[model samples]
Target: MKFNVKRKVIMQKNSILFVILSAFTVFMWYFFFVPPPEQSYRQTAQSQNTAAVSESGDNKFKRADLNESDIDNIYVKEEYINIETKQYKAVLTNKGAGVLSWSVKEKNGQWVDLVFPESAPVMANFPSLTYKIISKSDEKIVFEYVSKEGWKITKTYNLSDLYMHNLNISVEKNSKTPFPQIDLKWGPGLGTDSKELKENISLTRALVYTAAKPNKLKKLKDNSEPASLCKWTAIDNRYFLAAFIPENSTDFDKILLSRLDKKHPCSVILKAAEPKDVNKKDYSVNFYLGPKGYKHLRTYDLGLEKTVDFGFFGFLGKIAFSALTFFYKLTHNYGWAVVMLTVIIQILVLPLTLKSFKSSAEMKRMQPVIKDIQTKYKDNPQRLKAEMLNIYKSQKVNPLGGCLPMLLQLPIFWAFFTMLRNAYELRNEGWILWVKDLSAADQFMQFGSFNLNLLPLIMGIGMFFQQRMTTVTSDLSQRKIMYIMPVIFTFMFWSFPSGLVLYWLTNSLISMVEQYFIIKKMRLSS
Candidate 1:
């Protein structure tokens, strides 16, 4: 009987935690759906060597041309060259010596193309004309074109086995006249979106790291910033990223951002005009296109890890991610890694769990006497409060004991929620036979637009039993309200990523077991 009372008390405390979890989930829902405010673009000092640049209504950079002539009349047979590396395979075309397509390998051994099919070549023509391949190799490629007017353009690529690669663009003008603005544009979008894979249009956005801040471009406006201030610029979705890092800040004049329409993706343009008396101009940049893993990004030392949004409790989220990856290194499976992470967290807070258990048990022991006091003082509010304090003091029970320990752990709980939702490692990771992808819903059946996710249903059933095990209050109306929370949560988490749902489910199950053991230990001590 004592064990049952202790179990009931502990289960009652668990219900309170779930109440807090419901509030947290609602806040997160609001945060993800509501777009943030637009950021004001910075207009800092421009480079002295370059001409002034302004954005036109068509989302193109406009500058005064110095007697520029048509250079597209010369055409050569277009050819393709394949560059294969350990990390990715890229196809380049001689049409503009630009990237025709680049696909990065996912964990499931599937190639996901990063090039937006409907847009122009990722790094296409500076003059919008063909260039003949001067040199070609597995690791390096070079293309050069010379117009009849003596305007020369050359593109060089030094490939690597990793995500980071080098690109160099040089323009040589034989005549003394200044050449048109030499620029490199990477456009339209990053990775292709698929509804089946849960990739949505809202997840895609362009970002820039400047002045030690990462600014996400969400506004549909044209903006330009000094190249000297930009460390890197990127277009990324929820999982993958395509970024550009200027090797030398002085190599470019301005970094331009533009979008033709709200439906289209933003474009990034790097412009460097040849200074007077200097006939040749060179620009070098490093390109990174791969998954947004924190470990993978931190190696660049350029703050690329900022692309992974860890929320307000970022430090805790980082700790959780590090712990998660540490277990992944041992398990070799992200699904199992999540389970191990959940177990480790529960163990870490075992002491607090025990304290909360004891506090609740003490409260349960005094319930009979406390109820009598309440009935005796039902007419005198001030006397009832005094009597309650007297009983708590005499029993050596802290009124806030059970709740305070749980409150202290809210940040950790939230950190796990934020981290799991954005965890790139969980992408395409499988847990069991039914769960093929931890990053998506574990749908057992799909009826048109409705997806019947089994994990959430199982989770809801667990919550129902958890609430049924204990009554937090004797009031009939309040008990009915408490039972409704599980149903609300079941519907709320129905579409959440399976990895996050798995984490919560594992935590809930572990809490039940921990409570059982704590209750048993308490009974033995008595």
Candidate 2:
């Protein structure tokens, strides 16, 4: 009878663990492994257009109605001007007085160009007209174009520290005609490499800062008529960003996004506000084209840091990342920093771990007594429940003890998961032998044509032993399923980033050690 009671309790614990494990497996599978949906560009663009129109209720705001007509019978010499700073190098062309290319220097001594080479007319308002170089210098360049109608367009670029720069545009006119529509644009796609863009295409998006927050636009869509006015607009990917921040939000409120061309599928456009007077119009924009580093973005005070999506438990993830960076500052090695953070986390959760271990250990010891009581009350279900309750009360055992601890730890696990996966600091950063890049899977050895990741395997082994120490269930089926959990996790984590796997590995090792000592101490007390 007592055996039945112990079995029921064990079954309840196993069921909870199984449910939680399965849920986590499903979550990880969807987020990390599943490929994005495949759709045609035309279908995607139409869908986006429909959604945008519906959201706006009416098309009061004009679309990015830039005229793409050729400049007939007009000749202007084209010139390319290059500007180099310690942080980045930018090339500008007199053809449209727009940026030809901007490449930011990385710590690994590699240049990550933000502009896609295939996407021409990048960040240009007038792509067809060639402008004359009015002025050129090491830090600044000015281009001017005078139309046959006697209207002049001048674009001046001023370099600033880091990846920040300023573009001042002015139009001088002597006509009663309306001011020509102007929009600064960038797109098709932006990323560190083609592979990154291809894999993380879903992460690439257009963002408009409006109403004190960012309103994100759908990817691969013709979103050329967002409803609200924006302070700025941008095209951002997983690691880098190219944004246009108007010096005065009032002057650049209309934001447009278009993916009309197959070659240039995503274009972010920031339209200039209509000038009250047609005689002269001037606009200044602070352009930021560089990494999405939290520290760097925070310095700009433009809320660019919001671009980093930290998931639901973002507050905790931010704190975890902060701690990680703090430890890295001390150790000067991210691998060592991860180890330190894991140790600190284990220490903080020690109280919950100790309580869970004690509850499970106590329940294991009460099995024999519980079985005897169940037998005595075999025919009396109500009395059996009452007696079980009495025994729990006397023993100070909370039936939910073990389950609650696991539940409480889940938030921390998810927070770390989100933080480590999106951590830009881990990219290309090496940890130890064969783990050259923490952001990539650790390939310790090659078995013929198969590569084996050593970290996840070790982590799996640690998890198996940790479960073995804590598991009190005597049911054969439950035990089998419980034992298989480690193997299942091994394969799931096989392709995960090494830094994330290292955190889990260190966690499992710590839990096993803690469980071992707890078991030893319980035996001594008995």
Candidate 3:
């Protein structure tokens, strides 16, 4: 009797394991594999339009051209700042101080303005502004800004082209001379009430520059606004790069520059203000505008390195990138790398999964007994509990062991999730047989004119097989739920990246093979 009880307990444990594994497989397939319905561009554009017009009237700026002489009425300042670095020369200007422009002489001797817009029409009244120009060589640069009170602040720094160089700013003003100041006031467009600019600064073909500053950057009031501004200074007819310091307080200084065009590698150096002696009559500051590169940005440890934004999943993204890169080097093909990596990861986890599979098979064999117990216990709960515990103790089976492997897989799955979404190395990468790009959906088979991707279909088939091989349900409701899961998963995976689908398909195939071996072993042992 005791031996029978022990056998029964072991079988019951296996049955529970089977249920859990099946549920998890179904959940993963349903949630991660299904591709959402595509959204129309017109719909997206309408949504953006609604958001842009939602702001209160006080914060909105009227569109106008900066060339109009009426801009002078706003009290703007202009200056020229020149920057020289090892690879290139650049001029930064604050033309009418309303626009910041950058012109660079490339490595191949071509002149290009990293800033596309030469003039940014004035939209608001400035409380305070400063312009600076620095030159390491005879080449000219410009800087410009407008002030409400017409007080002009311009400084220049000269450094050699050979040394590791930067431009810094330190503001020192004379208390006696009545330093440049803008009267604080409020109203729409010219005062504190001026709504954030809502214009779209086209970056499609423009050279983009990300800002670097010590303080927290202010969030743009409107999402449609350009991430940065393009402006030029008329000083010496040279153009410089300028962007608003969204949040300025106390002595904190902000830095902005044009995007890095490999041909032009000039640098920009800017510094924060420091306390000055009481007798100082004039305010002084330093500004550097030049090259945008990795080595140059690392000089200041202000998380400026994050401009790379590997993607939303930071550190995980870095690891995925490194792993993908290493795999690419080994196989000389990204698609092969993805396949090999999937196989290796699956193999590494096989031991735990094998145990889970064994546990599941044991449970499937015992499901009839569990159902009998449930039926028997319908009248006596206490007796049923006692019988269940005795059966488990005798069989030497752990109910929790099967769940451990799945719990361990969560992080690895998440890492792969981020890897597929953000790794640049996979971009435009091609795979074998009808799958041209690993980064994009498979395009070989289409529904009508729309292409039905080969990989997602393959993934759906694999998942169906995986589900069929693993699920053990005697309950009618449970069986219905299990059957529906694969169909839902198939739809979900339809639009995901082919690389991700490939990984899922490979994992499913491996699991099916493993399940086969485990089942065969169970039958032989029984």
Candidate 4:
């Protein structure tokens, strides 16, 4: 009677352990393997709302009172200094701290605006304020306050007189300045829709001067700034302009604007100063306004490169981007380059994956032996683990080999995912038929007002077939759960970039092929 009772207790413990382990495995599969459904819903909603707002025809700027000023009229002077270079002409100014206004005339003689905001006004009750160019000449120009301000200061800097043809400007002190604030604006000549502008116009990049208030850095908000602010403004049919502003300062808001002519491709302007006794000594304020190309941006020593956000998985993204760039140089096409790189990566890691596949096949072969052991040791909980380990060791099989390959591939997979998402070169690149843009969905079919793509459907089908081929689960319930995964993934990836889907589909097909060959060879050997 005692022996029977002990056997029953051990069997119960073994069953419980099995149940817990199985539950844990299922939980991990759901948590990590399944993509979030909320992401799809959010993207759809955002797209719909954006389309609706675009159709509404609302002017965001017209709603604000831009002609009001609450501060006293302080003495302001402006100057325009023209510098000629081999490629282009730059107009530098000393009216503001840096280049108040500069324009680049292309070889086609079309002028592009490269204006930077040095300073402007901000008020408590009004929408954000801006400055508008009233007029400009070779020697002097006038600017009107285009926004409401409690207290405002404005200046311009000219580099023509400097031997180096570089200008430095500053905005010094705003102790009595009420609600001190500044606005900087720039954009492509094409205006943004009010909704998009409102949503996207925040300081995503800036070379902020923290020398004045180092301790206050922690208080700086993501979208708000105490000293410097940047914004985009559409100047004319020919030019996109951006303004940079430095608000109330205990010391001078100094900026340096280099006069490289057309080689620089843009201009920096400074505009701000508190009313004080005039001094003759010149204060240098450094600033830059130009194309966002990596080479152009690197001229400034400040850590301005942080603007490139590579999502949550940035480290992997960096590696992927480096590799993609290297491959792109060789192929001269990003789309083909991505494919080749993926193939190379797969080939390099093939041995590890092959080893893992072999281990999984060994495990599958041992399943019958495992089942027999489970039945025999049904009354011996500790002995069952020992027996199972012993059996695996004797067969020279690793239970975790399959899992290790998957783990090794995960980082590379994520890196490639990021590479595809942000590769600007892939933006308009073509692949096969109906996939004109790798960066966008292959919208080959449309259902009344809603579009369905060929890639997502293909991806779903591929996933289903792949899952069916590889799934070794004998449990009917587990097989059902496994089958549901492909459907979930299909829905999740339906709106992702076509390039990502292409990569996944190609990977799945390759995996299927590999599994087939490996399994067939194993069966033949056995």
Question: Residue 261, candidate 4: how far off, in angstroms?
Answer: 42
> Is 2 or 3 the stronger prediction by lDDT?
2
Number of the top-ranking candidate, with TM-score as the measure: 2
Candidate 4 structure, TM-score to reference:
0.57
lDDT score, residue 450, model 4?
75
What's the residue-level lDDT of 468 in candidate 4? 78
Compute the lDDT for candidate 1.
0.71
Model 2 lDDT tens row, 1-526: 2324556666786785776588577758645665443224333644443333323221221322223222441355667888877788888887677777888887767787887555543666555567788889977788886765556779988887687789998988775545666667776556465335334455667776654444532332544644245556788877888888887877764676665444324657676767774589888988899988887798987778877767679898899999999999999889889999999988988899889888988877777787788889989977888899889889988766876897798888789888888777887788988897777789899999788999999998998988787776565766776788888788888878899999999989888888889889989988
Ranking by TM-score, best first? 2, 1, 4, 3
Tens digit per residue, CA lDDT, model 4, 62-138: 21222324222122344444555433355544322223334444333444444322211111011122234444544
**Ten-residue stretch with the least lDDT total in model 4:** 118-127
- The candidate scoring highest on lDDT is 2
Model 2 alpha-carbon drift over 4 Å, by segment:
1-33, 36-70, 73-79, 211-229, 259-266, 367-380, 446-450
RMSD of model 4, in Å? 12.2
- What is the alpha-carbon lDDT for the whole of candidate 4? 0.46
What TM-score goes with each of the models? 0.80, 0.83, 0.54, 0.57
Sequence-dependent TM-score of model 2: 0.83
The segments of candidate 1 whose C-alpha lies over 4 angstroms from its true place after superposition are 1-86, 94-96, 192-199, 210-222, 260-265, 364-372, 447-449, 520-526
